[model samples]
Target: MKVKRPGLVTVIVDLNFLNVFLLIVSFFPKSKFIEQFGFYFNPTPSFFGGYN
Candidate 1:
């Protein structure tokens, strides 16, 4: 039997950045959950792609 030791370097990959980020952001009470009261209700497609 044998074992391999981990190197000093490491790599991390995930598909939940937004979810994780939001969770971390939630830790701070100052974070705003959403913009306005009902603006997020009827989300427009343009808003989703507005980042670009």
Candidate 2:
């Protein structure tokens, strides 16, 4: 079976969602997970629809 790779748009969308999730996580002051993955919330809307 041949596995097809996702397009760039799909990858960007996925990353955007991840960034949004991390942003929400940031709401909680006690959340340390986001800190570990720092820099994910720096994405601009022009790049990934503001999910960063």
Which prediction has the highest lDDT against the true structure? 2
lDDT, model 1, position 37: 29
Error of 2 at 35 (Å): 9.4
lDDT of 2: 0.70
In order of listing, the candidates' clash counts read: 0, 1
lDDT of each: 0.47, 0.70
TM-score of each: 0.29, 0.46
Off by over 4 Å in 2: 1-6, 31-52
lDDT of 2 by residue, 1-52 (tens): 9977779878999999988986778686455665676634444466656563
Tens-place lDDT digits, model 1, residues 1-52? 8965454322222436656875665565433464332223332357567633
Q: Model 2 Cα displacement at 17 (Å)?
A: 0.2
lDDT, candidate 1, equals: 0.47
